[model samples]
Target: MRASLSIVSLLAGAVAAAPAPKIPFVTATDVIPAPAVNARQSASQACFVIGSETLPKEVSDVAAALASSVTCDKSATTIANVPDVTSGSTTFSSIDFSQSSQTALQFALSKFATANPLADTDLQTFQDMLDVYQATEAGIRSVGGSLAIKVPKFFLEMQVSRIQTAQGNPPTAAGLQVDHLRDKVLKNAPRESKDLLDQVTQLATVLS
Candidate 1:
């Protein structure tokens, strides 16, 4: 009976000592829908029009002119009077600004890229934009909430290195702006989003 008791004790001790199973970390890609990803891509491309060198000077000038005409009126139901551009075969006429910010940005990029082959700088910019978006999206999705403000904050934090590499200039001003915006937005976020933001912040700490 003593021997059996000793064996049982050892088995119990072993079971007690076993480590708990680790929960898997959710990545940014895990949460971002395919449409969001595409939208971001499009937005990145659209932003390229502003500074692309591959296009003719006249075309770039026209793009610059048209950009000023596109107002950022979020309260409005639609973006009014978006310009169009025709590239080799694709023609992008108008983009609905009421869509996700990324989607709106994509409309801009598509219009810009339509006539202009993307320069090396433009490609780098797109990649930088994508990296930040993915990282932020992953953080937001991993924790599961509305913490969208965290996305921009995380992007600004993570994008500095990429922007420096791609543009030869740090995004210090832009980062600060995003940080400030995040702070302001966080104050208005719902309880669930705030909670998710905390989780994402923790993940960011680990990632950093």
Candidate 2:
């Protein structure tokens, strides 16, 4: 009887020690979260910049133009409890945004990729989030080819700079204009740049 009790105790201990089931990813559909911005507006403007078949090789100058055009503006929306975004076992909060642009972007992508064979969750939302990821990756890769990568690449650096300055760590806010805010803000951006614009917009919700 003592041996049986000891075996039961061991099983009970093992059960107690097991890790809790991980939370599933959150979806835009499930909870849009608060502080959502006019990402589509930025996206539209970016698409115009991307319309040229061959982007100019001058990365810094062109990127400055691209970044300048995508001034994120806040839109009024009903505030909902900010849902903690997760993908598979990875929570959105777990991803690092403080690294180099490439490293940070890749890290974010990897977290989402690992979520494949996704747990029982809405696939559409995951795919949409993934599109946003790929868009940033595409824009980064496009630097040498077509898309002028430095633009998205700068977002990472900008976040770092923000951390150093006052915006804190995150790339979404249009930042205070010590002088005056620039015009040509995102309003009717094309579909192509939507994903990248979205990634930037999403960062503001959590990091800002």
Candidate 3:
């Protein structure tokens, strides 16, 4: 009985002393590639400007009317609703631009250009806003373009959040990308963009 008790105690000690199984360290690459991370960061900043400030209030109102003009299935519920990110679907056909919508969008773009002049100013905010606006205009002119314009998913996400916020609805997944972009911008983005980091960071708090 004594020997058996000693053997049992030794086994228990051995079990306790055994090393815990190693948990695989997940590298940043395992979750998101460096290029993708940079892209998302860029998209968030650009979309924040486009949705929150760049596009005139009338442009968004026009977009809402254009969305109403389209025929969409039950899944096409709201402007805030976007396609599944993991599905690898880039374009959403839920909102097709009518001729009227196209005309309105073009007019809005023209207005944006005329209103926001890039004078000799060192403010990075204005410069970044201009860059995003030009890119959006190019997207609008692309073949089979929609009023929303094709941009990175992160940008679309921020845009949707802005729309929802305007409608008094809570932003869906608001801080997910905004917070990530906030971190990356603070750490990696150029000094010029970083100077305008408050605009993006403020979204994280408001949207959250």
Candidate 4:
């Protein structure tokens, strides 16, 4: 009788120690979508009217002209609550502008190469542009911290310079303006470049 009692006690203890089954809660499917800039508006803003087939050897000029035309209007929405978006296991507070810029530059370079395949001179220009890009990236990385603003200005100026070089002319006054901004940002970054890029990328995503 004592052995049976002991066995009953052990079974009761084991049952008490067992974890309860998990219960799942149902969620509504009507999740709010992220704010976005209309594709038509974004494309219109980025559109360029070029006459030549080649990636205007003067890439800087082309880029500057393109930049000048961009107007962040009503259709251009910021991707607010971007922290809600997750990448793998992590949720980002802002967009990665530098990475996006790098991507854009690479795409631009590739497009330019495709457009100017027959122009042997443009090949050297492309090489020089890549060199400048490498130096600029290295410069920003070495400086660190708020010194990152230099990246955008440098990128903008490089875009202008490339177009100018392609057109057989030196970078214009506007390119110099971007260069000045770059110098100031490099000397005193008001905010970290990485942070700035994050914000910019988040905003740009609305364009997508």
Candidate 5:
């Protein structure tokens, strides 16, 4: 629950500062080494800060979509609708279930936010973007080629934040599982994901 709380609040925060990164274009000639799962994730995150400078359109569109969706969903303001960021696609049993954890989550976030608000914001967006990027990457991993993902700049920042933060302690066992999920995205992303990546690159190129 503490983990999920971090996931949701972090994402929400990241969403608040999105779509500012520029896009870039380059030929997919360099077959960069598949990043160590954590390294790949870290690079994914750095892209966010990179995005703000790059301001890719693909990222902005996603941020707008997510922000709009939240605006339209009345229940979203409540923790229940936010979903258990730690759980798999399921809502929590009750606000009580969430409230039990909310205090802790907020505490941790607040503490981190107090010391590193910018990093926290970046971490949130990166994790949020994973759901989309993973679905895309999973498909391409088997195909043998570079894949692209047009992640929101905010989302990218969040991933980079997490990766950067993880560097200090190297993450716990649970954190390892989270890394696996991210690895799934890089290993399995498909054409659509590749397209998104290409889009990001193009946007970056144009913006640059």
Candidate 6:
């Protein structure tokens, strides 16, 4: 217990005062490689602070002291009702689920060109979307069944719209890093996922 407390005290100063992903978009593995499949899962399921990788070495050390008892969430239906951030729409009612999530996201981002960085209210809006993404990721993973793979598309689709949103305000260093991580996921996204994300007819702004 004393050892754990000491690690916590150390991290209080090690972690940055600014927002997360401050390191230009490197995932947890980049901060420090996971030892094995189960070890990686343990780190993944640990508390957010331990898993955040915001402080890299400091966080990795802290994670070693804690045991991950939490299980990965596999509830694929959890994201079904969440409103689309782009246009505030919901189009996932069909059986075939044919529409692609990557398509919606790409379309939205295409409208982006970097104007001004997000500010004040714009930051809040960005944070709201981020909260949803983080929450969804906590439970969803590549190891899950087919349903789990399909569930995250909605959130993925909204990101392109965010690029539209951020671009209108213009892309900041922070925003660009966010985009980088989003693309990494999209590129590595698991297969067999059905139709995901809401439909958008207009530009990203059309929905935002």
Q: Is candidate 3 or candidate 4 better by lDDT?
A: 4
**Candidate 2 lDDT, 3-120, residue by residue in tens:** 9999999999999999999999987679665874343333324422232233334432333334432221123111121122323343322342333354333444344331222233
Best by lDDT: 4
Residue 130 in candidate 4 has what lDDT? 38
lDDT of 3 by residue, 27-128 (tens): 766765354333323332332112323333333332333232222233432233321111112212322222134332332222222111222222333223
**Judged by lDDT against the true structure, how good is candidate 5?**
0.33
**27, model 4: CA deviation in Å?**
75
How far out, in Å, is residue 180 in model 2?
49
Q: Of models 2 and 6, which has the larger lDDT?
A: 6
Model 3: how far is 60 from its true place, Å? 28
Candidate 2: the clashing residue pairs are: 41-186, 41-187, 44-188, 44-189, 44-190, 45-189, 143-149
lDDT of 6 by residue, 104-158 (tens): 3443233222233422124434333333343333323322312342223433434
Q: Which candidate is the best by TM-score?
A: 6
- In angstroms, how far off is 50's CA in candidate 4? 31
C-alpha lDDT score of every prediction, in listed order: 0.36, 0.35, 0.36, 0.37, 0.33, 0.36
Model 5 misplaced regions, further than 4 Å = 1-116, 119-124, 148-170, 173-208
- Count the clashes in each prediction: 8, 7, 0, 15, 38, 4
Q: Model 2 TM-score?
A: 0.21
Candidate 1 Cα deviation (angstroms), residue 191: 4.2
Evaluate model 2: give its lDDT.
0.35
Which 10 consecutive positions of candidate 3 have the poorest summed lDDT?
A: 82-91
How high a TM-score does candidate 4 get? Answer: 0.24
Where model 3 places Cα greater than 4 Å from the true spot, the runs are 1-156, 171-192, 206-208
TM-scores of all candidate predictions against the true structure: 0.24, 0.21, 0.22, 0.24, 0.21, 0.28
